[model samples]
Target: MLNQLIHCSLNSGSPVTLTATEGLSSIAQHEDALLRHLFQGYQKWVRPVLNSSDTIKVYFGLKISQLVDV
Candidate 1:
């Protein structure tokens, strides 16, 4: 689905362009290259938990108080 859009954009020479110092071979290569560029330096690991070393316990709940018949 996305590949079709990339192909159309590449063929039509839209304002948006993707280039490399060397070159990309095909549409798949172009897509992979674009993804790599887009997600470069993205981390999948947690860096800090509220900037603290100790474990934090988060508490949450909902209270309901009512007497009715409906």
Candidate 2:
């Protein structure tokens, strides 16, 4: 599930990218283990996409605030 979301976030077109962002947001708000996994996946897969797109970066900036501390 997270792998698919990370793949979409990294490789899909704009519409899928938007949807994947929403999914990523949801996943990020999960328990610490899941959130940490998601971040690891992001660093490995989605970071390039996030780094290259200002829109994505902004969206993630807001969504990251929803991540609770472990």
Candidate 3:
């Protein structure tokens, strides 16, 4: 599921990218192992998107902070 979401986020249109980011935010909030897995995926797939979009980069940063706070 995470792989599929990451694939969709990487390959799909902007709206799907946004939705996938939002879903990733939710998953990060609730699941530590999944969040770690997500970060591994991030290193491969999501990092480029971060370079392209400030909004997503900031959101992803906030989600990381949320994990730290927990």
TM-score of each: 0.34, 0.20, 0.19
For residues 1-70, what per-residue lDDT tens digits would candidate 1 score against the true structure?
2233322243335444554333336666777877775566778665558675768677999999998999
Best by lDDT: 1
lDDT of 2: 0.42
Report the number of the highest-TM-score candidate.
Answer: 1
Q: Which regions of candidate 1 are displaced past 4 Å? A: 1-16, 19-25, 47-70
Root-mean-square deviation of each candidate, in angstroms? 14.3, 13.5, 13.1
lDDT of 3 by residue, 11-69 (tens): 22422221233376666654664455445535554453545555442433333334455
Worst 10 residues of 1 by lDDT: 1-10
**Which of candidates 1 and 2 reaches a greater TM-score?**
1
Q: Which stretches of candidate 3 lie over 4 Å from their true place?
A: 1-30, 41-70
In angstroms, the error of model 2 at 58 is 4.7
Worst lDDT run of 10 residues, candidate 3, spans 10-19
Question: Once model 3 is optimally superposed onto the true structure by TM-score, how far is the C-alpha of residue 67 displaced, in angstroms?
Answer: 27
